[model samples]
Target chain A: MFARNRSGNSQVLSTMKAKQKRYEALIHAFHADIYRYAYWLVKDQSVAEDIVQETFLRAWRSLDALNDEQAAKSWLITILRRENARRFERKQLETVDIEDVQVHDDTQQADADVSDRELHRMLGGLSDEYREPLVLQLLFGFSGEEIATQLGLNKNTVMTRLFRARNQLRETLERQGENRGRANG
Target chain B: MDELEFRRRIYADPEATDKEVVAAAKADESKRKFWNEQLQFDKQLRKAAKVDVPDDLANRLIWQQSANEFARYQKRSRWYIALAASVAFTVGIGFTMWYHQPISIGGQALAHMQYAQIEESHSLLPVNLDMVNAKLASFGARFDEMIGDVEVVNFCHLSTVRSLHLIVDTPQGKMSVFIVPERNDIRVPSEFNDQQFHGESIKMQHANIMVVGSKEADLGEMKNIITQRIQFSA
Candidate 1:
């Protein structure tokens, strides 16, 4: 009885250790992209980092529910999206206007081109409906169907949002280019 | 595919490998140029979206998780400690209450009669008036003179109320006298008994005097003697 009890306790301990290892691996693999997605979703770096931390913490708590390793990316995104929605629900009045907050990255701003800065600000200025699908495509390389599934939207809607998102950005860039060209001329 | 359909698909996904869209791009030189330009634009958009993540985020996450787990463990064990402390506190209160439970004076005097008999046999020094007075001084009372032939006198407890016991021999039989301090919480019953002896109590100035003897022995003489002889100082 004593030997069996010891073995049972050891088995539980080993399982906990394995879960921790898997959790650390998940964090290292997805933290960067997850943070970027959160940043674009909220248009605030600190809030994005907070949401990412909360997402990973929640993921750690429910890591056992995740079975397939392939679904991990979408799973993390799902948690992050929910975390963002909950943030709005918790602080509805405190939601920051996306246009008011610049997408600030000190390291990128240090050496990025003038056009790149304008593009970054334009991306941040895009509404959540358009920017979300585009960010998923650009960052995780998720297909339209995958973004639709992650966002709980139809594939056609995801495709249309992606199309409009790029079209709006292209128009903005072209207008900016013309203004700069005319000024130089 | 028409130009509008081609541009729509290409805008949605610049690297659209759909055969129809690819074929349309190849058949029209302008369509091919637009697709390539969109592709280049998508590359820039991808770059803008790839923001820099903080350097120590991974370490902070792992550290925070472990700290949370440690806090949860501490909270659980603290709950158990609180439960055990309250249990210990309850048991301690129960034992103290049981130890100090009230007892009837007559019943205790009768109970002490058996032990008094054994004590009478072992007692070597004959208890005198002065020796009795010395013990009674603590209760602020003393006997004016020897009340009876006190064979043995000692202090004893009747349900946590300290008192003095005096064993005496009389003409009728042996009688036991108990001088219990007056306490409002302790009830001094006027009469009580067991198989071997019966007892009676009298309320005095500073104490209650209980007299116990055999069923046939008259306790009135001992009660009267104790009442008249014992004195409480002002």
Candidate 2:
């Protein structure tokens, strides 16, 4: 949505065309990434979808603000994060941890085995602070600095949190192993 | 870096970008094994976190935006039309064959294209296709869902034959579609398009649906959409 330009209707027309191109390109490029990120945040497919839609709509409204195309991924993530936050602000959802909520899909069952399931369950139990950075790192291959920028944490803090996050995950799996060993004995 | 630090770094990020950590891991067999195990664990966590995404989510979002904007534009344009029914706006260009009678399949499309700039304005349709479909339902022809964004969904008085008029957007250009529940008994040709355009009429749910588009358009895909997407109210 470009402002009518003084250059001519052609300028306006070209700008409109460019806007559409940017919008469609952004959707094509990041729809899935945004959708997945939103899904993890909200844990509901429909709500996540609505967030992604709203995020893109906002993106379209201010596409001119997006100067560097390289930043589009984080840019979209920012929009989606705001949208997801808005969702909670609007109304209180059940807000249960997704790990506790029974996923009706086969994705959970497709995990390698019970240990894999426990890992995912433990991941869901992690606080948003640790979970967000770890997911950002894995989902986007985002480095510690990128995660810091994304979450507004210092790079060192993000690395330390990620380090603690992995340690907790290891502790969880080891505890599960201990229980299994005891049951067998 | 020391082995303890190397293992700790691997625990933090199995695929760590730290060159020193990666170099040490590659250089030592124990560090290499530990990193491999951590990498496998990271991969599993990623897969566990993955969820199924909707198949047509992208198209749905695009359509949602386009339809919303089109609705806004239509709201503004409605006033301009309401102000006048002048000679130019009232040209009623297509539907010329009966110019008054209900047109046959091919003629309905042929008449619809008479406006010349038919493809242009026809693309900006009234956004409420359900209302348009209800109007079609009056003639006993309706669709469960639209396959793509349509520009025109209205009734046309081509020669006196009342028919449902539709112009759906195609990749190459706009394809004019006319559905006549009244003309199934009428003898209709299979299909044809000249240098200027391409068209085909296929019988659907006891209705004559003729679609015509520019030569560049894929009438095959157009036809497939018509058959697959449109289901009778029954």
Candidate 3:
């Protein structure tokens, strides 16, 4: 009886170890991209980090439910989106205005080039609806259909948002460039 | 495709490899130039979207998971420990209750009377004097002669004290005699009764004799017979 119990305990231990290894691998492979996605989603670094941590914690809890390794990215995205929604539900009164918070600090802005900071501001300036699909496309390289499935929108809607998101950013960059040229001349 | 349509498709996906978009780009140089510029802009957007992740974020996630799991395991084990302690405490209380409980030989004898009829039906052979003596000898006591018509003779325990039980048919009714060895802890009552039966006990040299019968039966006669015929060896 004792030997059987020991073997059973060891079996449980081995499975837990295997699960931990898988969780670590998942963090290593996608934590950066997932964090970046969350950053753009909330447009706040600390909030994005918190959301990413919450997302991975939830992922660890339900790791066994995720069978297909290929589906892990979208699965993480779904969890993150839900976590972000829950954040809103919990603190509806303390909602941070995206426009008020600068996307990058002054020190980081000092290190970046002029065009980089302008692009960052433009990307951050885009509304959540337009920014999300573009980020999914840029960070994850998700196709129109994939973005639609992830965002729960139709393919045409996702395509339009992507189109308009880039067009707006491009138009702002051009208008800034013309102003810069006039100042230089 | 028209210029506006071409620009819309290119703006939507700079890397659009659809045949129509490619053919449209190939058929028009300005459209092709516009697609290249958009591709360069898309590259810059992709680069900007990849914000700098904190260096310790991955370690923190793994560490947090381990810590959370440890906390959960501790909670579960604490619950198990509490459950085990309560179970052990209950068992200890039960054992103490059983150990200190007053042993009532007369009450046991009365309770055994209900099974007396069942025992009578199960006994294959009528117990004679020798058979009764054979079991009574274990208590260092025996009957000199036949006290009555012995129906069933067996050894039983009355409140953890070993005893000999003999069911006999008398002129009054069926009576059960229990020959329980004398123990300091056991309380052999002088008289006891329940709704169905009443019992009388007698303390001898080394054992207690409890005679029980139905409420209507006279136990005095059966008690007198057993007391007169039984002898205890010193």
Please write out the lDDT profile of model 1 over residues A1-185, one tens digit for every residue: 99999999999999989999999998888889999999999878889989998998898889988777658888999989999989988886365765555444323543223456667889987888999999999999989989899999999999999999999998887786677568668
lDDT of 3 by residue, A72-111 (tens): 9999999999999999888963536555665444336442
Better of 1 and 3 by DockQ: 1
Pairs clashing within candidate 3: none
Write the residue-wise lDDT of candidate 1 on B180-226 in tens digits. Answer: 88886788988988999998888877888888998899999888888
User: Model 1: residues >4 Å from true position, as ranges?
Assistant: A1-9, A92-114, B86-234
- Candidate 1 vs candidate 2: the lDDT winner is 1
Give a tens-digit lDDT track for model 2, residues A1-185.
34445557888779888888888888898888789888777767888898999998888777888877558888999989988888788898775666656444324444335454556667777887788888888778898888899988898898888888888888877786776568668
Q: Candidates' lDDT values, in order?
A: 0.86, 0.74, 0.86
**What tier of docking accuracy does candidate 2 attain?**
acceptable
**After superposing candidate 2, which stretches have Cα over 4 Å from the reference?**
A1-15, A103-119, B2-4, B26-28, B74-234
**Ranking of candidates on TM-score, top first:** 3, 1, 2
**Could you say which candidate leads in DockQ?**
1
* Candidate 1 lDDT for residue A75: 91
lDDT of 2 by residue, B12-92 (tens): 678877789878977888888888888888988888666567999999888888887788779879866775555445566
Q: CAPRI band of model 3?
A: medium
Better of 1 and 3 by TM-score: 3
lDDT of 2: 0.74
Provide the lDDT at B55 for model 2.
Answer: 97
TM-score (all chains, Cα) for each model:
0.63, 0.55, 0.69
